[model samples]
Target: MRILVTGCAGFIGYHLTLKLIENGHNVMGIDNLNDYYDVRLKLDRLKELGIDSDNALHQNKTVASDSFKGFKFVRMSIEDRENLPQLFDHNHFDVVCNLAAQAGVRYSLENPEAYVDSNIVGFLNILECCKNHNIEHLVYASSSSVYGMNKKIPFNTTDSVDHPISLYAASKKSNELMAHTYSHLYGIRTTGLRFFTVYGPWGRPDMAMFLFTEAILNHKPIKVFNHGKLERDFTYIDDIVQGITQIVENKHTAAYNSDNLYHLYNIGNSKSVKLLDFIEAIEDEIGLKASKEMMPMQPGDVEKTWADVSGLERDYNYRPNTPIKSGVKKFVAWYKTYYGNSNE
Candidate 1:
């Protein structure tokens, strides 16, 4: 399969791209490489994929990977309405995994317009390209944040997401609506994965896994939101990638979802862990205790999140089995390797 992976430099996208290429699929990746987090991390991810850091950001110029044959990358935002269609036509991608978006809930409160531009506008462009080119499948990222204030133990796909509290959550809900419209009207096969708290090695700096690790390593006080009473379904990166891969490759039929053209699934560990317990896991792994700064919940923040991945398990045999203890160990090991040589 020849695939297009948007936001290829991102945490999830980078990992997914490697998995796809490893499975013998030809992949073309694209990212704006926005500085929402450290651009150096993005560059380093690209570097692992054999993309030269200096040349990975030239707009519209595609760079082929030196390490992997049939793997290529471009530095273009999916929101680029003009060139996206051209790229689609030129490449004729069989599947498009749209992971590119302005991610982050708290940031959405500060820059709501960025969410609109990247999540809404950029997604519209993707739908248009798929409809125009008759693309096979469009698998995109959604968030557990959409299940805002639901009071449900396991956040299921059928749960009402009409009351999203944050702009970021709203944007993801909007993406699902947009994809459904396209699927119903134009027969575009689409699947939306509502990801829970995804974390692991090469993870985003803004996420808890990276933040807690960095803070603990440097002996900085880690902010304990909600007075250390929050809970999350911390799905490891490998398990998340596995769910995605299975969905992308699985043969869909009318038996599943809305006539095989539209589907939504929760990709998560299906177990919620307390914030303090998670922090303990990090501390135990790093062998360094973090100074805690207890704080109230920020606006648009939820107390807990758990995923109902039963649908995914039944359909794709997806089982997220990475225990919290083991996952933290892996991330800690990678963090040491990655940040140890700071001046390299």
Candidate 2:
């Protein structure tokens, strides 16, 4: 199968692209490489996939990987109306894993336009291309944040996600609606995976795991939001990738109703670990205690997020089993190797 993976430089997208390539699929990856976090990390991820960072200039030029014969990469934004269509028309992609989006929930509060440009307008371009090119499957990245302020114990796909607390979550919700429209009109099969707080090696710098690990190792104070009362269903990257792979390979076609070709599922670890316990895991991994700075929860932040992935388990036999302790240990090891603790 030929696959087009957008945001291939992103934490999840990079891992997903590597997995697809390992399974002998011809994969073309694209990422704008915006400096939302450190662009260096994104470049390093591309480097691991055998793409030369020097050649990854953001000019829409496609760069073939040096190591992987079946892999190619391009530095382009999904919102590029002209080039995106040209790429679609030329390549005839079988599947499009649309992982590209302006990601940070808090950052959305500062720069809402970024969400509009990448999440909404960019997704529209993807749907248009999928519609025009007759793509078989369109699997996109949604977020658990969409279940904002809901009193539900475990966030389910069937639950109402109408009240998103953040712009990032709202953008993801909008993507689901747009995808359903495309599925209904053009017969394109669409699936939206609402990812939980995914953390592992090559994780985003803005995320809690990365931030806590870095600060703790440096003997800096770690900010505990909501006075250490938060909980998250922190899903591991490998498990997330496995679930995506199963979804890609599974040919369970949706029902024949015009509006039935679209589906949504939560991809997350079912266990919601407390914030303090998660921090303890990191501390145990790094052999250090963090200076704590307890603070109130920021705006656009939810107190807790617990994914109900039974829908995913029932449909795809997916189960995320990586415990927070083990996951944090792995992340800490990677961090030490990559960023070399000078304090050691």
Model 2 steric clash pairs: none
lDDT of 1 by residue, 293-325 (tens): 999999999999999999898878999999999
Worst 10 residues of 2 by lDDT: 251-260
Tens-place lDDT digits, model 2, residues 250-317 = 77633222356888899999988899999999988888898999999989999888988897888788
User: How displaced is residue 66 in candidate 2, in Å?
Assistant: 0.5
Model 1 residue 80 lDDT?
Answer: 95
Which regions of candidate 1 are displaced past 4 Å? 252-258, 341-344
Question: What does candidate 1 score in Cα RMSD to the true structure?
Answer: 2.0
The prediction achieving the highest lDDT against the true structure is 1
Q: Which RMSD values do the candidates have, in order?
A: 2.0, 1.6
Q: Which ten residues in a row have the lowest lDDT in candidate 1?
A: 251-260
Clashes of each: 0, 0
TM-score, prediction 2: 0.97
